[model samples]
Target: MKQFQNNSLYYDVDVKIIKQSEHCIFYEMRNDEGKGSIKSYQVFPGIKLTYNDFHMGQCPYHNPLHKDILEINHCREGRFECNFINGMYTYLGEGDLAVNTMVNNRIIDSTFPLEHYHGVSILIDLEDAAKMISPILKDISIDLYILRDKLCAGDRCFIIRAKNSIQHIFSELYTIPDEVKYGYFKLKVLELLLFLSIIDTSEQFEKRTYFQKNQVNKIKQIKQFLTQHIEYHFTLKELSKRFDISLNSMNSCFKAVYGIPIYAYIRTYRMQVAASMLLQSQYSITVIAGNVGYENSSKFASAFKAVMHISPSTYRKSH
Candidate 1:
């Protein structure tokens, strides 16, 4: 039932809180521009949430309020920093989570240029929460109690996974009918709470495994960086420098994670962009080539043929 006032100068904002439960609710908000803007809402209380995916070089800031909300951030892509109270700072990369509690908090900063960050947040409304938990049975109370403790403990990974799952659930709410969406949203919220609850009881989820998780995180960051700056010609060396990894490391990571090298990935991404432009826009082949980071038309043609198995002109003709 809380109203959000639009403070963003970039666009008009509208937010809708769809469903509310003892723990969380569903919500949606949309920005009018639809460019670098998102509108979403959820009924999960106790968190004032802000989810943003921005271009490189932009630093987004949220000034601390007198009454602090429990803040959890997961960097799905790119890199950034969280500046806390008393000048404490933490750098977060993909798969990394950061937590700031009301007790000790400050501002957040993004360190990389042309970076993107996507994550979710859950703010606990303590006063309302007490009333909600009063009616639950002792067994159920165990989990809720544990979750509450961890949030107070400022468990970073726990918060990240919980918020990430809730955000995914919120995204799915948009497609379903109101009744079904509400039912599903509540289920997801419960799942998130239970996940947090288990985290409180067990220490297994806190340990980072070297399996695909770390590589997956790096891949997400690289892919997102590529998607946002598709027009720029990205060399392996440049990408390595941008991500603070070596060329061999970058290539191995991409190949192991994506089943392709960085160049092949970029080429495919470029060709896909070119195909969309060819079909959606009236830009000529030369312009499209330039737009996709190709300088020579013939070179672009060969690369396009290698990927699509057809020349750019032929592909255009077919489409």
Candidate 2:
């Protein structure tokens, strides 16, 4: 295993290159939170496609190495938080897409809200890509600079919520045969850019909610409190009073951060906990239900089926 030192090309202190080949590099990062790996493939001149898989809560602090670069990210699973330098935060959930230039709009912090994320990032070295792409096919024109201006004008990050057109382009990327991956990547990248070029920015740009730091902190605290005492259920009013935040703000911010409502998140979390206990322990379903704040085993079984798609007994037996 050769070690690609931190800060060598584009990485900061939190990552190291674990493997490398002719046209691919595998980078891994580990910290107190957890670990992740990025598999990068050089497909075209000044353009690369990277598959990002992280089991950790936070990514390594990113410091853009290139001055002229455009990053397009597609979230295939989990939620991603982008903390801007202007003291604002936004998130990218599954099937969402984000387009931005690293020069003007910089991300101060990047984290996975659910502590796990699987996604794809296409990094374009603007200067080099702009010069190289157009001449490849005279009939189809691709101008990187124009695409940047159209998508990320005024340093604003352009986000498109999950649409079938975008999904059609990205879904194939996750499952490509190794022998044809290199050629398929070129075709797909070009297809994506062509689609973006003709995209009506006016209709595609979504009004994303941005949360303030103070509100985000309070919401996080509320999450920790609720998760720590998962055996108890609390009302929105009670949580609002305990956290000293308004009721409406709590709902919106929690959804923004975790991509779900408070009731839904906790219910899913409790079921997950119950599922784990089911497999790992010899505890009966009634005891497990009570531990997760469900007084009735029948009710617990129903909820577990709703979330886990199987009864607690069946789930344990299958696993």
Which of the numbered candidates is closest to the native, going by highest TM-score? 2
Worst 10 residues of 1 by lDDT: 4-13
lDDT per residue (tens digit) for residues 1-319 in model 1: 3433322321223434444543333444333322232333444433234445454444434333333344555555655544444433334555555544544333433333223445444444454444554454345653344454565554242324324543454465335575565456546555555555555435334343122334445655988899788778777777778777667656765664444567787888899889888888889899999999888888988988999998888888898
Instruction: Give per-residue lDDT, candidate 2, residue 163.
Output: 85
TM-score for all predictions?
A: 0.50, 0.94
Q: What is the lDDT of residue 172 in candidate 1?
A: 52
Identify the runs in model 2 with alpha carbons over 4 angstroms from their true place. Answer: 1-7
Candidate 2, TM-score vs. the true structure? 0.94
- Give RMSD (Å) of candidate 1 vs. truth: 8.2
| TM accuracy, model 1 | 0.50
